[model samples]
Target chain A: MSILVIAEHDNAELKGATLNTIAAAKAVGGDIDVLVAGSGCGAVAEAAAKVEGVSKVLVADNAAYEHQLAENVAKLVGDLGKNYSHIMAPATTTGKNMLPRAAALLDVQPISDIIAVESPDTFKRPIYAGNVIATVQSSDAIKVASVRTTAFDPVAAEGGSAAVETVDIVDDAAVSKFVGEELAESDRPELTAARVVISGGRGMQNGENFEMLNKVADKLGAAVGASRAAVDAGFVPNDMQVGQTGKIVAPDLYIAVGISGAIQHLAGMKDSKVIVAINKDEEAPIFSVADYGLVADLFDAVPELEAKL
Target chain B: MKVLVAVKRVVDYNVKVRPKADGSDVDIANVKMSINPFCEIAVEEAVRLKEKGVVSEIVAVSMGPKQCQEQIRTALALGADRGIQVETDAELQPLAVAKCLKAIVEKEEPQLVILGKQSIDGDNNQTGQMLAALTGMGQGTFASEVNVEEGSVKVTREIDGGLQTVELQLPAVVTTDLRLNEPRYASLPNIMKAKKKPLDVTNPDELGVDIAPRTKTLKVEPPAERQAGIKVGDVAELVEKLKNEAKVI
Candidate 1:
């Protein structure tokens, strides 16, 4: 059996999630090939070729795929779907946008956000806002799935020597056009890819208080995130939300500051290796999952925590 | 131009869900049922479009058990011109749901189709994109902002890194995110009027779509509960525990 792993990258470097997804692809036990589809992405393909255990790297660089438009990228991936038994991508926004469309075009069902590889066709995934974990078995001939990057360890990026093959480009249907992007410019790592995440809640009160978390984050080299409540309250943008309905992050360390630890919020980061909750309320649900709990106002505790770090 | 909105009936977001004893599904019996929160946002966006006179009419569609009509009525109360119910008690997968929506799209030919990014229950997050593929339409998934133009729609999407903007031709599929718009509550008078609104009922068989479960759910079990830990006296103790015991720092 062969596996086709879709690589996620900016023009320069591959996202850490893609390496983690390669780990998942390794678990499926196959001759794995990584596909780097982008415009002017030779450097990305070069980086993907060095990922350990990858046998081949297929590069589809074309102007039509410049912005990774779902309409265009899905067609490119679907056209290449027939060669592999299992096709996988990380459960990022780009993967979520493109995989289902490709699966539908292939007349197959797409298994989403698989956290565990039970067999080749059976997988475990979260359902009901992560309240329940469901084991799903796909009976289709081709298994299409998106790996929850946090569930797997990233493959080493420096060890492998795989050949990179350039493939013919697919024509853009011109049904949709990319109208530019507005990305949050941050020096810290992204929330999902960060080793440590510092998340604030409604208790932070306003966007101004988030600066305190940023100070702590900078000290710890962590990414800053917010609860859905904080996002709803406009304390931060929706892109920074970490919850059941938002981005699910499983970092090595998660520190919740003044967050009430709603079930929705817990679903996002409960899988962290270590959790620390600092809330004024002793009865907050966050304490239940925290390895270390501090019952103090975040205004005081966060500053002291930053100083100590 | 016409707008089509899809809504789903799910357990109210406030209710804490538990798995059944047999590990089949969540024990949703007697739980408060409501429209999926993101679907409500989609319905609200459609109603706002009709109010702006950009769309001539708004048709709400749902595919679920008979009781889902309650949600259809709720959409009507929110301002959909009519409702279509594809009645089925069997649990439908995302692909099947997309196929059913494709059948409806073939007949209605709405210039714009809106659906929630994912249902709160299954959280599959596939229907809208699959529908777009099955029907050969452009897609704008996870849209935070949407603007309809003469022959196309511009959508600003909330993605992982930040936000992305895209433009799709008319008759495209747009899936909503939470930040789209606040859904309005159905007033009492509008609720009463919704009871008089036209609701057409049909089934998957009638639409010539096969609604089959593509993936079998082997088991449903609650996640491992985390034991409550001791509260630290201050940040120093917390840092000590994180360093010595957890060793994750």
Candidate 2:
């Protein structure tokens, strides 16, 4: 079978989630083609060609696709996706916005956020906020699915050489216009891609007190995150939240501090290889999932932890 | 301008769901159900638009069993003018629900349609965008802020990286996010008044839309449990365990 894996990029570099998606496509046992749809994204297309499992890369460079708007990109995907057996993308915000529209255009039901590929037609996904795992089999002619990147190990970024082809299809509905964006600027690594992640919660008390965690994170070269409570309490922006509705990370090391582990927060970080929790409440549900637990006040523990590191 | 807001009745967010003994599905037999939180935000947004004199009327719609009408009434109590219940006993996926909504959209021809970004139950996050596609309308999903102007609406979306603002022409689809606005609780008088609001019921067959499942669930199982490890006494012991035992530091 031939599969089309949509590449997620910002015209300059390919996102790591695309690599993980490629790994998922490999597990589906198909000849994979990467589609890079963006204006002046030749560099991204070239990078996609180098991914180990990709057989080919299709570059659709046009101003209409510059911002990856759903109205325009969905039309292009719908038109081209008809020829493929399966169309897949990483379950990110961009993919989530565009893929379902394309699936509806094709009159096919989209299977979202699949965590395991049981077969070409069957997959396993999390439902009810990851509390239950459901195995679903698709009966549609062409399967459209989104891969949960954290569930799949990413393929090598540099290995193979694939031919790059230009696609001259432009389908702009012109019903919507991109106004602007405010992306977070961080010197540290991206949360989902980081190897080490340190997060705080409501127990952090206030926004300014996050400096203690930040100091430890800097020493460990880890990305910093916060719980839904912390975000709602105005301790951090929504993007920093780690929960069912926010970004899911499966880092090698996940350290949660002063966070009374709610089930929603656990859903995001329980998959980490190593989990450490420091909370004064010994009965905090987060300690149940943590590999190591410390029952101590964060105010005294955080400073000592930073100094120890 | 007329506005259409869609709501869903789901398992309450606070309830801890578990798989049944037979593993057929999550056992919500006696669990308390409520309006999905994001849909409440959608209804609140529509009410605010009406309060600002931008929306002339608000129509709240839901597709499910008879019980979903309760959610629609909740929306009316929150200031919606009327309600529509697309009653069905069939298990509706995102595509089928979108088809039913598309039929309603075609008949109502409202200036704007708003829905929750994702229900807490399925967490599919697809119905609004799929409905927009089926009706050939532009969509603004995961909306944090919405402003209605002449013939257009500007939506600030909550994306993975941060926020993005997009301007869609009228008759567009917008999905609500957590930060959109705080939903006001319904007063006792408003709850009583909602019973008098007009609520019309229709079936999917009357809309001429096929509501069939495209995917079959093989099984449903609980996630693997993570066991809690030993508790450390002090910061130095925690550091030692990370470095020597777990080697994760």
Candidate 3:
């Protein structure tokens, strides 16, 4: 059996999460071939070939794919569905958008966000916001899924000369939409892929106070995150929210400052490898789960933490 | 254009969820349930669209226990014109839920469908896209902004690198992101008005779909706890800890 990993990236550079997706594919113990589907993604295909445990990289470049339109992507992956035992991508907004469409078109159950591979065909994943873990065995002709990149280690570049094949592009005008552009904060680490994260809460008072968290994050080389209260109050964008309504992050080191631990906030970060809570309220719920708790005001604690780090 | 919004009831976001003694799932006893926040946003977006004269009707739908009626009523109170509850006691995998919703879409024949990108309880953001596929319609997931024009809709979406805006034909599925719109709370006056709104409760059997669970939970456990690390006093000292002790940098 062979595994097909759909490499996700902009036309310019590959994302590190693709490496972790490759790791999940590798765990299935199959020859891994990656598909880079987008316009002018030859560079990404070349990059994919250099990753360890990958045997081949296939590039399907066309203007129809500039946006990775879910319609066109499903058409392409569905066309290639007959050739592999498994088709996977990193579970991101993009992967989540397209893979299920492909899976539904294929009439298969998508093993969403597999945390582990018990075998080439059986996998483990979380359900109900990490409330339950289930081992799934796929009896479908082909298994398809999106990998939660946090669960696996990114394979280092082995610098190989693997073959790059250009596949026939599928043109489907069903996706007649174009996203004008996005106002992305280029300085921040992609929250989904960051290894270490520091998030703030409403206790910081307002948007400007996040500067302290940002400084400490920069020092630690961590991603800056925010609580739902902060996001709801307009301190930051909702994408930065760490809660039930936001992204689920499991970083190596998570430092939360000025945040009372709402169950929603704790739902998002409870899986971190190390947790440190800095809050003035000794009775804050965050202290119960925090390995290290500081009952000090963030106004005093943040700059000191930044200075000490 | 007509619109459909899907909602789900979950354990209140405030409750500290513990695993059942049998370790099958999170214990949900005594939890105050509410409309999934994102779904409320979706319903709000649709209702706002309706008020703007771009949309004609806002149909709210939910797939859960009979108790989901409260959530449906909540949607109506928030401004939905009507509600459809697909009665099912089974634990729904995203795929099965999509199937049921797709059946409703077939019957309602609305021009637009909206739902939260994912239900917080399941964290499976697949239903809308899956339903779109099952119904052979286009989809815009994680939409921060939505606008409807004659025969088509424009959406601004959140992606990893940045945002991207796309347009889709009507009879489309749009999932709400956190920034899509600020949902309005139901006023006491509106709450009274909603009591008179039409809510038709139906079974998954009536929807012509099986509610059998596609996936089963084997165990539920709190994630392993993290080890405590050092906290330093200043930047240079922290740098010392990183470069010398922890060596992560």
Q: What is the CAPRI rating of model 1's predicted complex?
A: high
lDDT of each: 0.92, 0.94, 0.82
Residue A300, candidate 3: Cα error in Å is 2.2
Q: How would you encode candidate 1's per-residue C-alpha lDDT over A36-106 as one tens digit per residue?
A: 98999999999999999999999999988888888888888888988899999999999999999999988
1 or 3: which has the higher TM-score? 1
Q: For candidate 3, what is the TM-score?
A: 0.92
TM, every model: 0.98, 0.99, 0.92
Which residue pairs in model 3 clash with each other?
A: A179-B165, A307-B234, A307-B235, A308-B233, A308-B234, A308-B235, A308-B238, A309-B238, A309-B239, B111-B171
Per-model DockQ? 0.83, 0.88, 0.46
Question: How many residue pairs of model 3 clash at the backbone?
Answer: 10
For candidate 2 chain A, which ten residues in a row score worst on lDDT?
A: A261-270
> Which candidate tops TM-score?
2
Return the clash pairs for model 1, or none.
Answer: none
Using lDDT as the yardstick, the better of models 1 and 2 is: 2
TM-score of chain A of 3: 0.94
Q: Which stretches in model 2 have alpha-carbon errors above 4 Å?
A: none
Better of 1 and 3 by lDDT: 1
Against the true chain A, what TM-score does chain A of candidate 2 give? 0.99
For residues B1-249, what per-residue lDDT tens digits would candidate 3 score against the true structure?
678999989776555566788877678887889888889999999989988998889899998889998899899999999999888787777777889899889989999999999876767788888998888888989998888877888988877656788899888999999888899989999899888999888877887876665545556766555454444444455445545654555
Better structure of 2 and 3 per DockQ: 2
